[model samples]
Target: MFTEEPSYDVLKTENAFLRARVQELERALEACVPRESAEEQHHVPYRKIFDALPVSLGVYRRDGLSVAMNTTSLELIGGIGDEIIGKFNILEDPSSISAGFVENFQRAAALGKNVTMPPCAYETAGSTLATIDERTVWTETTYVPIKGDAGIEFLVECNIDVTERQKTQKALEEKHALLQALIDNAPMSIFANNLEDRTILVNQRCADAMRLPPEAILGKTPRDLLPEDRAEEYLREDRQVLEKGSGIEWESERVRDGKPYHILMTKFPLRETNGKVYGVCGISMDITQRRRAEADNRRLQEEIIRMQEESLRALSTPLIPIAEGVVVMPLIGSVNGTRAQQVMEALLEGVSRHRASIAILDVTGVTFVDRQVADALIRAAQAVSLLGSNVVLTGVRPEMARTLVEIGADLHGIVVHSTLQSAIQYALMY
Candidate 1:
């Protein structure tokens, strides 16, 4: 992390204000002027505090020739106050010339208007002088005009070091630029709006979604980009998020590029440190493809279910007519409770529909019979007999006979035949 700027540079505030009020110094202007001897200057009115002030201060004639230097100024110039006093001229200083003081000299120094110059490095430190500080002093200098009888008589010079403050401000600008880059490159649409319903922030993705650039999108309301109905709906949702001070999510449909898309949107309140809602933030993602895939999967599942039911129906009760009063029921696959029930229904229905005297069930293709299958067969025979028909079972396998015997199935009135043809012949003879 970057180091924070120190509060040292702020001392110049008081120095600049009090140092420039030359009217107070005007009372002692005659006395404060530098004399031939240094010992007598201390006795001048307001001389003690003015020299002891913490900032760099100097007095110069309207033409910019140095007249006097404060205690701080003497320390910065090094060696002795008598050495550079009245010799240094601000108009000839390299930093001041580059700062346009040479061009604007009269209006600033000779006139009554005070002017504060931009921050610049001063070479009066250890560069040429024998001062203690080895580094260059960066300072903001101010020239205040002191007025008297005919016109402006003198100018008061004040300087404040501002090196750290300058660096801190530049550092903050760099951090803001870096954060802006990251937000612009994000994939999803992100935006925020103030309580006035004006857009305060928007990512590049959101701007592109609205078919506008970031600058065009910001400071605009929902109605600026959308139809009246849609805009009102969006604003209403934003208000809800702010009122609730919580997040909400839902799916909505939006049209883009002449096609409808599903958007998964979420809105939340942006709060201050005091927990007051200031604005609303929103995030949205396109989910049209995902929604389409889910719908396709549901259709496929329904189709598969229909196909399975058809296959089970075809497998359960397959029937064929053999003669005018006889029908044949062919059984196949392993029998379950549901399929067994279908078999019984088919047999009774066929006997009544055909006015058949016999319903022959061919179990040649049947797998091993369980108790459920055995019970289904007996019930079918009894039902057919009640419908004025006789039940004949043909082609019983050895396993089928053994299972029926083991289960002690009671098929007392049902007739048995060797094959489907023989059962049909017997029914014809009857």
Candidate 2:
């Protein structure tokens, strides 16, 4: 009670001074804490990160010491986690690394930068295995300086497994190669075209058939390679397929390198992934030989018909009639210009051979007689009349007579008989 109540002004000054000093210390502490350290700062715990990683991960020191390793990393290295943490030198161990790997790591450490490498096979426990950790094995290995209370403590190493991705990439490459081979060696001329008939893909056979390299035909339409009139026919067919969304097969005649080709073309509508018709796919086969054979067969068929007609006409011509010094010729079947000529020749020869006084021409079975037949008949009668033989034409249908008159057939010196018997009786009576 006697000592404590004396100095109130001093106590107030001391208390204010203490509060100001505390504020100053707090500001100093804030100033002393660095926002970002120039030295490498490991904000995330490396040990915790390594242990938590699903894939194998390891840390290598500058001296090639295995400073830290996860469970998967230790198992892949053929050692327990505790055993490999301080003992394994990934650079010096040939069983775990490829040639020049140590040199590459040393170079990266010296340059204080990242260096990437190609994949290499490593031997582990007398068996060759592919290293899946690209960061530690094949890809870029970064060496960053880690500063701690102990100076330049460790070199942070990361392992990234890229095995599954690499395998998929390799499989894709092989598929691409196989597809290229199939396109190159295809038998027919396979081609792809746009809606405008411009070519997009052409197989080897197509290039060869066009007498050009594959590069020359790319992006070219039939119009670019052929005459405009010819190109229009091809483009028309292609447009039909695209518009109708159907397949078309046709024969195309092409001229390449001054040689003619008969190409059997088949075109189908090409659809996109969304089921929209984008273009057409076409295959063409060389059918020159087959076309030639077909033309030859047609010619032979025509020749056979001509020969058969000649045989029929020859057989149809009657032998020279001997009875009553007269010859009778009966007409049958449809008569055309060619058969008409044959009939006239056969009749004239028969008249000359018989030297008959009367020649009877019958036409009861004749189907139709045109101007050509009427002209041949008139000419034959004139020829027979010149040979001292009177020509009597029987079986004159009313329609045929009108047609003959309309066609201006001259029958001034010819005798017309309605029946064959009437002609024969007239000849015998005369």
Tens-place lDDT digits, model 2, residues 1-430: 5776758899999999999999999999999996766434646675676687766656678778878778766665578867777887867799446555576666666666655445443434542453443323322333454555755545655445555666677789999888767987976889888877789888888898678999999899998987798789778878888777899888878786799889888999988899988788888888899999999999999999999977877777654584756888888777778777777788788877767788888877788888878888788888878888888899988878988899889897789999988988888887
Q: How displaced is residue 271 in candidate 1, in Å?
A: 2.6
* Distance from true location, Cα of 416 in model 2, Å: 9.7
Residue by residue across 364-383, what tens digits does model 1's lDDT show?
Answer: 88886787777777787888
Cα shift from native, residue 108, model 1 (Å): 2.8
Using lDDT as the measure, the top candidate is 1
Using TM-score as the measure, the top candidate is 1
Once superposed on the true structure, which residue ranges of model 1 sit more than 4 Å away at CA?
1-45, 71-83, 101-107, 118-138, 289-370, 373-430
Each candidate: how many clashes? 0, 0
lDDT of 1 at 308: 89
Quantify all predictions' global Cα lDDT against the true fold.
0.81, 0.76
Instruction: Quantify how close model 1 is to the true structure by its C-alpha RMSD in Å.
Output: 18.5
For candidate 2, list the clashing residue pairs, or say none: none
